[model samples]
Target: MQTLPVMHDADTEPLDDAVTRRVQARVGTVLRAKWRIDRVLGIGGMAAVYEGTHRNGKRGAIKMLHLELSVDPEARARFLREGYVANNVGHPGAVSVLDDDVAEDGSVFVVMELLEGKTVDALAEQRPTGRLGITEALRLADQLLDTLAAAHDKGIVHRDLKPENLFLTKDGALKVLDFGLARMREMQSNAKMTKTGNAMGTPAFMPPEQALGEWNRVDARSDLWAVGASLFTLMTGRLVHDAPTLNQLLLKAMTQAPAPIRTVLPGLPAEVAEVVDKSLAFDMNARFQDARGMQAGVRKAIAWLDKHGEPQNLVPVASLGTTSPGAVDSQMVTLKRDPTAPMAAPARPSRLAMIALSLGTLVLGGVVAFFVFGGSSGETPEPGPVASSSAGSARVGAPAPSATPSVAPIAPIEPARVAIEDAGAPPPVPSVTASAVKKGPSVKSGADFGEWGK
Candidate 1:
């Protein structure tokens, strides 16, 4: 009964309020979770990405299927599988998948390493100024080739290797992302077509087989064409081909030859340009066998550049068939020299000098230079006195002196190696799923991308 003077219930109301608040606060207890989806970052056709954090507070990006597609079982399956594939195909240049799960609403979500980068599409939009430097473009091409090579070796073909798919991370790493349509060659082709009524892939970069919707026939060469097209854009900041419709696009892919690299990026190394020409060949057989081959060529060109000075004068190799015999002006002006021959004497004044003056006003600068060093040595030749004469006063009919050594018969520069054959009527429109057309220098087409397979 002596319970601290029986405190009134109303007085204890404040304590009761504190107790209530504490209990309610416990309801907000933080639990250990892999990642907490923060807010939406971007929304795409198939998924929406959110900025997220792990339980330990590590930052990441989480992709969730768009509500519209999340309900579709097939779409969800493909979404989940794509996440798994992204996780497994862990290349430094490929986006990495960290975690994945199915939400209560049957929506699929994937957590990936948060990256700071811009897509190649963005880069293309803001193309670098001046002619596309071969070294820079080749460097990017080499990285892409590495990424594609790995995918191909794993029996995976990136059906969509467009500029948008390429990304440059904050650390200057190039990554290939969104492999949603990448197909494993070992697996059967997917029966589903894209929304465009043809197969997946951007039309501008699609190869002949891809343009025709010949998904089953796609191989590493298809990727080669894409890489070539990509290189063309990187070098020229323009698409190698473009079409208003799917049919026209396919027709061009079948018949058109990419414009010469020099046509856009003038002064590109002949060797490097030739490599690009080979990669962009309309015929799959005419293209480099794979991305690796293209990469090897790029590396070789890089090595050549590193060894020699800047490639101001790349002797056009015979491999680039697209170039005509007179295609390069520099090739016409030969830098006559012999690897094993001895040096020759300098040239003397010619007939023009004999008709004008007995002795030319030996450049005052050259005479000064001669005397500066001439007076220092016993074997030093004497600096002839500068002599001047009136117009046509002397040596009017004297023959010109030939002090320079006789030149050797020089070898003619060879034509480009790959001799392009005018593309020749669209390769006769090979029987295939897609049809493309060459409009001007760009390729175009009108086949329904979604229905091409059907």
Candidate 2:
């Protein structure tokens, strides 16, 4: 028997080696009287994917469960379930599931659109220490969020989100692959798919809640955590959660806090780091409320960087809040005992916060003043006299509806006064009178004012 080509994941073990060779020897074998297998593409714990062709010259990838795994009813159910989920998603970002069926020997197989591009893992390998550039990372992240946002809208949660499951098309579009571990909100109660307390995913990228096997608690936000982890790995070339063993890995994911991106890549942009940090929040509520929210935030950050150049300094952790759109927090980073950093955040309120507070104070002060100085009193004050500047000083004493303020009315509007004008002059300029019965030039009983000494 020919040996099977090896392609294994550390966290998951493949079926028995004897069974693998028995399947690998079937290369060049035709199936369904219409599709022919070319060779083995790769092998996973449960299925072996192959490059295959239909008699009509159509090309695609075929996912077939090894004969050994096919015998088990549970494994067969999973193999067929993946095809159903991928097909139901019906989005361009998700790999298109075409056909699924059981061959003559009861070996199950699924046909999918053959993609020519590499997985994100392969792309990462070609980059600088597996870390992508800031702009590239943002660009890719935007696309991925859009994918998850679409899936989320369909009530599908991609529980297993990782670089291995994300395919970067040769044309530069991103395709989210692998739905074998996804859970449908509508299909949750189905016994064929529902299995609680048995979490199946790449542990490094799994969110804390999912890591703890809190299956029922998982939601769209759970996928968001993986999105964050993928981006973290994309830019830093390191897993946000890492360990030497599975138990320790799951433990760390559930109990440990991911190091801030700036801690690993100190030169990363603050806006970018902030968005990633929030997406990876230990509390689900602290994360972007949804995938679309995350998309907007990333775009907002990228727009900021485009308009105002990137800043190269770090700030205090407490100062950082969820940097969503319209929130007051944007300068957040993981605090690492660097309170003395030159560009540390201020302890006082933010500049925007201070401005808002001052405005609020002004408004409150105005309201108080209105009540104290402009509010109604127990008694009403009589209307003041209107002094007629044209009538000269004699008009002040004329109590017959003149423009001058009434002397008797001063008791109500206490300590208040008005100005009378010299209307006879070229221009009317009002002058304040100290005394209601004034001896000054402002008003008079029978004296000449602006006319000077006559």
Candidate 3:
């Protein structure tokens, strides 16, 4: 018999040596006359995944139940049920199960969409401090909460949620893996997958109720606790309760209150600390009641980070409201303004208002000119306080006064003259003309015309 290496972690128990050999023997063999097992991916307590290729040249992952467990009807039923539960999650983050069939040897197998990515735990281990940067960590956490919100909405509680189960693809998308231990609310009364006193899930990520095996009390909030614990580990590089023995670790998770996130990373923003701390509260009621509520808390922390110059790189997995696009929270959209920057200029007046103002100014100037100089009588007035030659030359769209003295010179309006006088500057020249006023001045970009211009 050939021996195969079994991947073991804090979350998965190692299979017996005998069972390991039996699982490895399936390699190079075809199942359902289509998917041919190429190699073993990983072996766990209940199932082993194999990389398989179909006869049609398509590739997929084949998750096969352990030969030992397949003999038991209940175990086979539970193992096959994973496909149904995960598909019902109705989220893009959830891996899709393609097909399920029974092997010739009586073992059951299910093909799933093959994913290419490292688990969160593996990525964290690659980092120097075994901790992700604040922005990256929160971004992943936000995506995780979004997936959980979808699962919770379907009345499914993922009893087992840990760093190892979250896969971050090369394209920066997060996928939630492993729904084998999920508990459907509809099955709570009729079927008891786990006895009331038998503990389940990874001890490091399990909440008080799940660690103590209070199956009845475990609900959506229990999953939130696991999310908090997973984030605590990703940000701090340490578990909430670490011990030498599994029994000691489980004991601590059941009885001890998790240390505040700030205790581990003191420089963490208060908004982030509050969300993680509240999620890990010993009493489930103190934690976020639903996935949406917890998601909102995470968004607030992200918003706070944005204000503090800690922008995140990950794109949002979902819009503000999962169902309604218009229900976005104001805090998430609003950014803090820079106090040192100049105040924004007020809104500009409409084109119609600008035309009206220019027309009014032209009519008033024409009335003053008519009263100052000769009117419709067509007689030139005496040269009293004669306007400067420069003023007449600058008048736009108006003919210059005839050298024969038959035409009267136009003077600048009193208001225009007052404005120039207030500046204590040179003699002002008349610029506005009847034709020019009819065709208003062109508005140039960034040009400020004071209140009227705006």
lDDT string, candidate 3, 1-454, tens digits:
2233454322334446787778777889999799999876656555677778899988888888777767877677767667888888989887778888999988888888777656676678667666687777889988988999999999999887877677776678888877867888776765434545556566667788877667789999999998998888787776776565545566677788887876656667788889999999999889999989998998898888888866334222221211111121100000122335455454555666666656655655564485556455777754444444532422333344333222222333321000011123221111110000011111100000000010
Top candidate, metric lDDT: 3
lDDT of 2 by residue, 268-335 (tens): 77889898999999999999889999999889888977887665332323232212111211110111
lDDT of 3 at 154: 94
Clashes of each: 44, 7, 2
**By TM-score, how accurate is candidate 1?**
0.58
Regions of model 2 farther than 4 Å from truth: 1-5, 8-17, 191-196, 308-454
Off by over 4 Å in 3: 1-4, 8-21, 311-454
RMSD of 2: 31.3
Better of 1 and 3 by lDDT: 3
The per-prediction CA RMSD against the true structure, in angstroms, equals: 24.6, 31.3, 31.3
